[model samples]
Target: MEIFTTVWKDWTMYQKSSLLLMGICIFIILISCIYIITRNRRLIIHAIASILCSAIFTVGTMVILHVVFDERISYIYMLIPLVVFLVDIISLSMNLGYYTSTRNKKSFSPISVKKELLRDSLQLSIFIILLFSAISVFMGGALFTFVIAMGATALLIPWTNYLLLYWIYR
Candidate 1:
């Protein structure tokens, strides 16, 4: 209880505002996703992807904040909703495009989609991790910055996979 109080007192305006902003964006995205899903029952896969990605983001944020206990954690949190929404929108658009392009096809096989998603996600995650590592080492050159960059990159993997899966199958 005392520790919680101290932590709360130490919290800055940035952290509070970041949390509020994240919550608002998440609410909007959630509503939009639900609307899209309801309109097109075929997009059930999207609902699953969004839910899984959201869970991963939420858990990663909580764990990182707990481990670091730093004010700068809010900086990472602030970017979460923006990244999630951007990926969501892009993937949704791609899914729509794919659907229209293949309207004549009876159905997309889940097995092929899964294989492609896994391979693409692994490739993308590796690229992202390496890119962040290089940027942190070359630009920041600080252990702290490296750790933060790596953490952010780690948090991004699930969302990337979500994006790929949605794009691949809709």
Candidate 2:
């Protein structure tokens, strides 16, 4: 689209690399989440948490960046990735809670290596997000909007999986 082309022209190589990394990270995180969500049809908390956290993270990050840094990127550009990164973190947090809950133990399948796997996955995802934020800060906030775009991507991927599949099929 014209908008994407214009935005693409405006970003630097570092900013673009950051965006690509963020996109890859979001895709991996969302894929894992979609798998879990499909497997555990009884629980919808992960999906809900991802949505709420996406909104909160987007607004919070935007306000904080505005106050702490002096970058002038479009709101749309910044919003795309912030939502993505936040949703993954949120989804992982909910997953951690669910896996550790008493309810999990009561299920027919006892707690096993799956819990460990989930915990590790969540930790890795969180670490990546922290890395993105830290690196963006060190880069003088120029790529901060791309980082936000990553978060936004994280938010959309899981929820739109069905829509994506439908589009592909149609």
Candidate 3:
């Protein structure tokens, strides 16, 4: 209990620069994951570009929040980009699954709309969880607690994708 309290105090003392550095590291890791998943050169280039754009947008928003609104840099700010990255991952997974199942052919089936809607809803749910996690973290929740919440939220992506694929096949 004493050790945990010490760790929490250290975490609370982390500076804005440290948070920014961590965010940059996560962005790099995300781009690397994209490259590994999609080996096509053009796709890798596009994915890196997209990730860079997202990083810029997030940093810009944080700057505005800090300067204009006087918001402090915290774990909550990190959640914004994390959620955005998760949504992108879910969307990419769904698109890849759809294309693989359809063999790159145009879908003329009536169920396509349903599949798309499900994918969209899954993305929305991810966003909502992101919002919730951010709020919880900002409220001085334990780091492990917020991590558990994120992990639980992440489970939905695979489950939603699996169910969607099963329905599409059936």
* Best model number under lDDT: 1
Candidate 2 — worst ten consecutive residues by lDDT sum?
160-169
Which lDDT value does model 2 have at 154? 56
Model 2 whole-model lDDT (C-alpha atoms) = 0.51
Clashing pairs in 1: none
**Residue 55's C-alpha lDDT in candidate 1?**
51
* Residue-wise C-alpha lDDT for candidate 1, range 54-101, written one tens digit per residue: 556645655555567543444445455555545444444544445445
User: Which runs in model 1 stand beyond 4 Å of their true positions?
Assistant: 1-38, 42-45, 48-52, 55-59, 68-77, 84-100, 139-170
lDDT of 2 by residue, 12-131 (tens): 989999977976676567656755744553233344444455555555555555555644446555555454655455645554454445444546232332444345455555765676
Backbone clashes counted, model 3:
0
Estimate TM-scores for all models.
0.52, 0.38, 0.42
Full ranking by TM-score: 1, 3, 2
lDDT of 2 at 23: 61
Q: Give the true-structure RMSD of model 2.
A: 10.9
